[model samples]
Target: MRHSLRFKVALVFSALTIVLLVAQALGVKTFAEAQEEKLITALIRDDIANVMQGYRANPALLPPFDARLNGYVSAADQPLAALPGSIRNLSEGTHEIVLDDREIHVAVVPFEARRLYRVYNFSVYEKQFRHVIDMLMAGTGIFALLTIWLAYGLSGLLVRQVAGLARQVKALRLGGSTPINPGKYDEVELVGLVEAFNDYHRRMADMIEREKEFTCNVSHELRTPLTTIKTSCELLEQDAAQGTKSRARIQQIERAADNMRELVNALLLLAREESTQNVEPVRLARMIETALAPFADRLANKGVETVIDMDRNVHVAANRSALAIVLSNLADNASRHTDRGHLRFSYADGWLRIEDTGSGISAHALPHVFDRFYQASPEQTAGHGVGIGLAIVKKICDRYGWPVELESEPGRGTRVSLRLPAAGPGSASPDALSAVS
Candidate 1:
């Protein structure tokens, strides 16, 4: 049922050869039979004419009987009474008769004074015909075998060419080689396939390089304005009136600016593909507080409760800027979705879980939650985002070999989990860094 291209080609080729050979055999047999009949008819007619002339010349004399030619003469009292029924009508043409197991050709000649029957044995011709048929059958068998061998060899060569192309395509996919030369193959479609794949690879590489350059440039240019805003907020917080709530608001603005600076740094490192392994032990609680700082006012304005369940002494080995970006993105996503119920961040069993009570993802959209620019529902995400937050988190985690998982149910909630590696000698203690409190 799963036949290969080569097998199908060979089968069709061999079948056509067989049909031609069979036709040739039938034509040869028919021609031989026709020519043999003509030769026998001529010989019988000439023999009948000679016998009639001889008997007429000498009525008392009978022509000599021979093996190849035989005849019988009836006496006056029994005039050809014992003659075969096939020649009883006394016709003047060649006719065939069978006697015992031998076939005979009879030429009946009626003269004025006497009647003559000329017989010629035709069994020898039949034997020759059988011999020729046997030879034709043997020749056809040889040619059929030759046709099979030739078809198989040609098909094998074609299959080898296709397989070589497939191997080259595989090498290209694994980033093991450059484009293969399509000119080596004579098939037009295969040449097109090679050329098309090579073109696509070149275009993809160029596009990614351009995107990386843009990200690096943008992150670098935006840092100056972000720094100025941080400095302005800090100044505003210090010189504000003592009893006013504007002081606390300015403090919040400073924390948000700090978070933005960390995010820009992380993005720059990502564009350069730098390893963020400058491992430092930061207190889990303090890290969470700093990450949630920018979203604090939003949560309060939305009346969304915040629940933090993490140990103060639980420290992890990570780069501060990169970890802050990852945490901020996750926490910001939770805050944006949840309105009334609490947004929870819990750390246990080396896993960090962020759960939000909001319109959860549909079953159809859940699998593609981390795909770039994928939205669960157009109506839900219309004014929310361009769907890049989770995609960014997934990309950062993949770069560091971290595992991330998501669970969601429609109309219920969504929960995201990040699995971190356990602390080791490479990690520092929480006491080494000042807490954010």
Candidate 2:
């Protein structure tokens, strides 16, 4: 568990306050006790001096008596057993003793022929001091609670701006022209950070604009030639005098042109960071067959059987062109890698899976297989194109919020799974359904 900055700051402040309060309380207690001791000593010494003087002047005069103080004078040669047991062995000095479970301060003094003992009972004073200590502890407890509350509030105030900035950053959208308003913040550091983020966003938007223009220009320039090639091939196919091999070669060229056109469309879609709104229901089985049509001859030549296990009633909602590109690329890649095994396509539990029993990917190369222009090895590169097929598939899947996963083991083959968007209500077409079925 990680603590928030606000919580940490509050905790530090509370700890410091508690420490200072405890230290101050202890200091006050120590000073009060020391002063009380000094007062007791002064009073005892003054009384002892007066008693000695009064006794020397008139030997018959007795010492003053009170509830807290008592004076006792005895012969200097009296036996220790003659005095109270608690103070019997007292020397000529003041001492504190527990007598009858009560605290007593005793002062012993020796005159020429007599010994004097002054006893002060301080148990009442001790009870009063204890009451003061209890009050101090209560005050400390109340003060600690108030300090913690104040610290928490102060910490929240300190981090309020930062928390607001985080929310603004989170809400920011890609390609949005609006920038965070640095003017809203009073702190110089926060303002600087907001300004830096605005600059970065502006640069990114400009780059995206440039990319859009480039793709648009490339689409126009490249498609014109592809359109011409396809038209020329169509015209040649209609010519009765053209040889069978010539027509076949023209058909191959036409297919290549169509594939290139789809690639360009897929790339342009990936370049733009926007969702397509032209989504409609598409039957999965028929779409899969159409996507694999181009690879049929190749798979047949390699003796690689193609199997598609999807329900005819199953449908998905997606941009037709984008989904077509994704399916075609996956089918093409699977067919290219397999030599003589089977390529299977199945849809179940919201996932469209493609499995191939082919020359499986190595552990090292599997991770990088989806990377653009990444080739596993030279030997695998002969028929397996310049590795952008899966990369394009990945990009298309990402654009549509589809989750695509790939798994492979050396000498065991590869499998890919893609999650598709569920179709909306009443999306199936009666004519299309019958045709595919």
Whole-model Cα lDDT per candidate? 0.77, 0.81
What is candidate 2's lDDT per residue for 41-63, written digit by digit as tens?
99888877877888889977754
Worst 10 residues of 2 by lDDT: 74-83
Clashes of each: 0, 0
Q: State the lDDT of candidate 1 residue by residue for 1-437, as single tens digits.
A: 79888898899999999999989998998998888889887776676666666767876677433222233442222222234554556566676767666666666665553446655666776888889899998999999999999998899897877878878878877775577888888898888887888898788778878988898689868888888888887777678364478877777777777877888877776767776655666666778888888888889999988888887667776667777888988888888877778888888898988888977878988899899988778675588789898898888888766689999998788999988765675556555544333
- What clash count does candidate 1 reach? 0
Model number with the top TM-score = 2
- lDDT (C-alpha) at residue 229 in model 1: 88
Which 10 consecutive residues of model 1 have the lowest summed lDDT? Answer: 73-82
Model 1 earns a TM-score of 0.51
